[model samples]
Target: MATRDTHNLRSVLAVRGFRRLLGVRLSSQLADGLFQAALAGSVLFNPDRQTSAMAIAAGSALLVTPYSLIGPFVGVFLDRWSRRQLVVFTNLLRAALVLPAAALINGGGKGVAFVVVAFAIIGLNRFLLAGLSAAVPHVVEDRRLVTANSLSGTLGSICFSAGLGIAVLLINVLVSAGDSGYAVMALVAPIGYVASALLAWRSFRVDELGPDHVTAPKRAPMHSAIGDVVRGMGDGLAHLASKRGAAYTMAAKAGFRALFGVLTLAMLLLYRNYFVTDDDVHDSITGLAFVVVAGTLGVMVAALVTPPVTRRIGGWRWVAGLIAGIAIALPLTVSSFTQPLLVVAVFCVNIAAQGTKIVVDTSIQHECDDDYRGRVFAVNDTTYNLSYVLGLFAAALTLPADGHSPTAVFIVAAGFALIAGWYAVVAGRWARRVGDDIAQPDPVPTPVG
Candidate 1:
């Protein structure tokens, strides 16, 4: 099975159009990481900037919540435009917007101007991502679509992480230069976006990443587009209601993402206000970077182990076991938190998070009809980000400035325990009842919208 998966992956990588599209994804995501890191540094880790848990939550809300709300519907318009052109336009817009965002950072402008530009850039980033996902089917063959998505998505994540690491390094190296230095770092990200735009423009025809000619239509009016989203979401939920295994596992995934967000907020506070003493923002950023590294390593481990492990124990069992492991391990590592323990805790949490995600995605693919799969994912993506934001706000209300609340940590563990218990009891039974009947379905072609 591993060998076959490998062959499929290689076959997808061999396609010229797919390779070009993958290049666009990598470079665009790399810029995303760079921009995100810069924003985090300017807002959270700046020595001169004072912040609290609530402030952090508000910042997160401002940056992420809109994406959660508006992202699902953006696909309505994606179907109307040529995806390749949309990609090119969005990358160019991001590049243009970064200048003001950088300037605002340079001048220390956290006022409305800065906020608007920042919001626009991030919103456009979301739009770009939706377009990219929609374009995948046009570049890859039908048979290898799953492998194509897996390879491209995995490599895109690595590129984003690389960009993040680079930005953090720049922040630390320019610690003395402060906001000015961070502004310079922000300037670096546009080069990536511009390069991505150029790749898209030069490598692919305007209609190459496309809504096929037969299905393509004029842009829907705003009201009509919104109505479509509402109807699609309802239909998606109905489909999930009938697919018990997928629905249960998806609920588990949302719960995990929310808890992960809570832990993330706690970690950020701990690093910024508790672990690093006196205004040493450099070491604070470094500590957080270490957590990222540990989590990334754990994600890598989960990716390597999950397929074979799930094949043996089954998806639900593997997912239930991973969450159960996290439930048992989190409080043990996080309650008496030290820097090393922080890394260990993040490592364990991501293993569960990514492992569950793999199973959940697979379950959705297997259980959902192809027509409904895209909308199910739209619902899934909406809940995923919203849950994370919800967790942030929930934690903000309860967590102290120093983020050293054993109570909060334990509560998170309890939350995980509950999710694991539900998965075990509900999803586990469903998996057992189905037995060996569960099988992979044909890849659902990526919807243009």
Candidate 2:
């Protein structure tokens, strides 16, 4: 077994390419944070907007569903094109898309135009992120993947939260409590996106972050891209099917995400409506923001602890335990709808969710072939976004205006328990099939241009 000292984050960051990649990841996520916060504030919390659990679910669906629908196909391009170029082009495109979105918000437009543009921007974001995940192995050694993922994912999350905070502050300082504030906040995201694009352009040579030089088919006509995408997605799924461990890990992560989505939507409704009487929008937003802050702290702690814990208990077992932890923690912490208890629930769930994510990411990176990594991660992304949307819709149906539904919480807990059991069975079967391969250390492959 490798000692703790070997996987230290400082040693991983010492790699120049990884450091540059981290910069791109952090910058892009910060922009996403700002963009999402601005959109949420405009759509859900503006005084002119009618806020309800159903509306919140609709908003969440709008932001995520397009990516869920189109993200898998986009992964095809990730494998065919230069990922470094994808990172650069996608960010630049996103910056352009944000312009119309910001204008629509400023002009009080809320129909199809706004939704279409917003959807496109987020869809591009999915491609950019998948490329980054696929490129991570190229930038760092396999032995250091856990530490690298922990640092990048955890810190990128922090940057996102920081960006949201900055957007809120910008709104307060720049404009009134209506559409104009949201509009101005939307403008901030473009700056971050442009900066991220430049960083990506300057960070790596063309094809340095790669699809391993395998012969890829020539780009099809525009009319055939969709067909290509479907075939490509099928291929990706087949590849993952062969790697049972990665496939099951994604399934477990999807279940955890669905439960987390329920918790998120419920908490948003709780703060926006139930926690504060008299519809005090400001206080409700403040309460939700505090919960986010607490969750961020919990994510940091999870990053600190997960590497060691995964090392101690195999990554698969550790993920199973975290999933089980959610089932146990959810009912215990959130059955009562008080603010203090909800804060605790948020903190605990974030730890489990983030820890599970770290394990799943590292396991996929280790177990899956490099050539198929982007598509696999794209499928993983699709699973997460779609499952969360499903959970949101489910919560919208069951949750009352007050968001105090122990029944709903219990249902989610039950789902978590079922998922945990499924993960255990899958892990055991995979272990038996692979024998000691999971335990044996393999040298990182040489990078392909």
363-408, model 1: which lDDT tens digit per residue? 6656766546555655667678789888999989988888889999
lDDT of each: 0.78, 0.82
Q: Record all residue pairs in model 2 with backbone atoms less than 3 Å apart, i.e. clashing.
A: none
Number of the top-ranking candidate, with lDDT as the measure: 2
RMSD of each: 4.8, 3.4
- Stretches of candidate 1 exceeding 4 Å from the true structure: 1-5, 78-82, 134-150, 174-177, 205-229, 232-245, 361-374, 429-449
Please, what are the lDDT tens digits per residue for candidate 2 over residues 1-449?
A: 34543546768878999999999989899999988887888877777767778877887788789888777877777777788888998899999999999999888748889888888888788778778988999988887788888888899889999988887677556665578888888888988899988998998988789888744467679768777778888988898998888778888888888877788888887877788776456776678778889889989988988877776556778788887888898888889777888899888888888888887788778888877788888888899899999888888888888788889989989998999998988886786778622233446689999
Q: Against the hidden reference, what TM-scores do the models get?
A: 0.86, 0.93
